[model samples]
Every structure is written in C-alpha cells, then in structure tokens.
Target: MTYHHTQYLEDGSIASTLADLARAHRILELEGHGDMSMGHLSYRDPFGRGLWLKRGNLALSEVVDDDFILIDFDGNVLEGTGLRHIEWPLHAEILRARPDVNFVGHSHSHFATVLASSTEELLPYNNHGIWFAYEGVPRFADTCHIITTVPLGVDAAKTLGNAQALFLANHGIAFVGSTVAEVTLTGIFLEKAARFQVDLKSSGFTPILPDPEEAKEKFDRIYPPKAQHNFWTFFNRRLDRVEALQGIGISQISLPSAV
Candidate 1:
C-alpha cells in the first residue's frame, strides 16, 4: 500500500534523515552539477521499515530542516510536499533492485550528456578519470524521453549492473553511491572524467593511461565511501545549518511540499 501523506510531520528520527538529503541536494544544486529542478537526489531513511525516502522537488536551494518527503520502496508518495520526480521509478526500483544502496542521484550533467550522446565509454583520461579504467561504462542508448515506468527504471538499472556509473544515450549519466556524499561526489567526478575525455577528443590527442595495478590502488582508497553508512551522516549535519537560514521552518514535510 502507498503511504499516503495527510498530517504527519517527520519526527526527530525521520527529520534527521530528511535533513541530510535536503542539505546534499542543496550542495549539488549550488555546485551547478545539473540544471535547476531537472536532476533528482534521494536517500532511504533508516526507519519506517526502511521504505522511506527524502525526495521530490521543492527547490533544492530553499529546502531546509525536515523538508524531505518520505516515500516507499515503490516510489509512491508517503509524506512530503510535492509530486515525486518524473523519473521516480529510476530511484525507487534501483534501490529495491540493489539492497546495498542508500542514495541514488539522477541528473543530466552537461559533460555526462555530451558523453552519453556518444557510443564510447568514459575512459581514464587522467588520474581523475582513472576510475573508469578497463572497467568500461555501460550505455543506455534508448533515447527515451523519460523513465516514468517501473520496467524502464528496472531495465536501466540492470544495464548499469555492478558499474560505478552509466551513460544514458542522448540523455545523461547516472551515478550511484551508498551515501549522499559519495553519490554527489561521484556525480561530480564522473562529469570531470567526461570533460577530460571531451577535451582530449577536441585536441585529437591520446591521453596517457595509468597502469592497471595503480588504478586499482586508487579505487580502493575511495572505496567504502568513508566507512560505508557514515557518509550519509556526514552530510546530514553539514547541510542542516544551511537549510535553517532558508526559512524552511517546521511544517508537515508532505510529499507535495518537499517534492
């Protein structure tokens, strides 16, 4: 059953989770990682049977304390401020498909869009891009308008199986992380990697590559995203201060409100 939003304010427990998500979204928006309101970021609350999320659109910049909407594993609006993201399935299904994840960030990053429009994988063009080494990126060349259906989200997530990132044809890229910080940072890093590739292509020069073992070592350093689950907590406290000044005072963080 869908968790309908009526008159329930996110309690301290749930509010803490929303605090993290809203702060993270604000950071991504401020960084100009994606267009305004075009990208979506979500985190699964540790409570509410682990079927709750903090998402939908409500101006990432203005989102403040306890302004995150909670949803089920099925993308149905449970509690928050607005309608779910157009590609709600993209976040819900993938989270369901992969129990290991807590954060899912979807955006039409400029560099990612450029690379997505191509048939190539994001190769390691520098020490930064070394993350995409021999581990080629998977592409979803469907050119579909939007992933509004569960099946579509499932298919796309499957295509991205076991990969750190994905390049969606004629669209953009998707980066998944176990935490909000990691997911947000990975999205940024992937764009950097894509930009490196684009620059090299423009110069018509082959960029030097790092050795396999060396790349693996770097990968391990960035792994576990700061002790697994802790990454989410780190950003939660960091963003709370920013949201407080935005005037997003206490309110029923209804789905429609936060969304």
Candidate 2:
C-alpha cells in the first residue's frame, strides 16, 4: 500500500511536531545521551499513517525540520532524500505493534547502555526510577546485531510488548510513548535513573528502593498529562536559548502543545 504524509503536511501540525522532535533530539544530545551519532527520535504520522524520522546524515544535535523523512511500516522511504537509519525497522515495527504508541526514542546513551550491559536490575532507587515500577521495563535479550532487517526489528518489538521502554542487551534503550512529551520526558528521566543507579552501585552503598505503592501514588500526583505539557514548555524554552539552535528555526516555529 502507498503511504504518505499528505494529511500531516496540509494540517501543519506535522511541521510543528517535526520541529519539536528535532528539538528533542538536540536536548538529548546536550544531556549527553547521543552516543556520538546513533540516536534517533520519531513520531507516528498524525493520521496513524506513516512515521517521521531523521535522516541518517544529521547529528542528533543538528537535526532540523527539513531533516525529517517519512516512511512506511516496511521501512520504505516514502518522502525526503538521504540515508535512512539502519535501525528504522526498530521504530517502524514497534509503532506497528503498539497502536497506543506515537513516539519512539532510541539511543546508545552512556548510562543506560552501561546499566543494560550489567547484570544488575534497574532498581527503583528514586522517584525517577520509581516510575518504571508502574509497568516493569523489559530487556531485549537477543543479539546486538544492527537491526537493519525487518525480522530483527520485529523481534525487538516483541520484547517491548506493552512496556514503555526496553533495553537491548549490550546495545541501548528504546522508549515509546503515547505522545511526544511523554516519550521525551520518560527518555530524560530514564537516563537520569540509570545515572543514579550506577552511581549508587559504584559507591558500594545500599540504595533505598522506593515502595511500589508509594511510588504509584507519587507518579499519579506528579506526572499527570498536564505535567507533560509543562515539561514540554520548560524544555522548549531551554532549546530556545541554546546557542547551537541559532540557525535551526526551532525558535521561530510556533510549536503546538505536545500533550
């Protein structure tokens, strides 16, 4: 079946969302989760159509509105020009499998990768980590080969079933969300949680794991949908001030609320 972003292109929401996504990538880079150049963030088409992803040539920090390309579930590049990420299937398959998910983030971020390679469980040592307690995160234990093939992506998606995030063994972390803000915030927090967990372990001190019940209560109170919009606004403001964004046009784009 032919797929296109015609609906999103006309509505203009896609343009705004693409800018936000590029900003999210830059934010991840500034936070040091970019892993040199192997990180990506994508959004499902507004009409539940295709996926919008960054071209492989641009660094996460340098992504702009024009850097995004549209693709179908089979990884075929439907629009735009340039190299598609070899891991495109990872996003495509997961979006295909999870109708609830609208955003996907992947990064060989330092802390998360280190934690994933270890035998230690990602314990809930803090509020940031406690959020994962609502639904335990899964680890994709398959081979760490580049997920260039459709089958490989499908395997990764199977491992990620119904969970918000998944750690690829010896690889990195992939996060999914029902909206851009949720996924972006979760990605940021998850990276923070990894840092906290690793730091405590390295110090040889026993960390206090948050009670699941209390954690749930705290999560509900602190991270309702509205909180995501607040976060998006805060982060977008930060992006606006970054020196590297001078020519990126993100500041000029009137980004719609990410809720």
> For each candidate, what is the lDDT?
0.63, 0.77
Model 2: per-residue lDDT, tens digit, 23-46?
788777766566555789899988
- Residue pairs with backbone overlap in model 2: none
Worst 10 residues of 1 by lDDT: 1-10
Give stretches of model 1 more than 4 Å off.
1-13, 48-59, 133-136, 222-259
> Taking the tens digit of each residue's C-alpha lDDT, what string does model 1 give over 200-243?
77786666766777777776775444543353444344444545
* Best prediction by lDDT: 2
| Residue 81 in candidate 1, Cα distance off native in Å | 2.4
Off by over 4 Å in 2: 1-12, 244-259
How well does each candidate superpose onto the true structure, as a TM-score? Answer: 0.75, 0.87
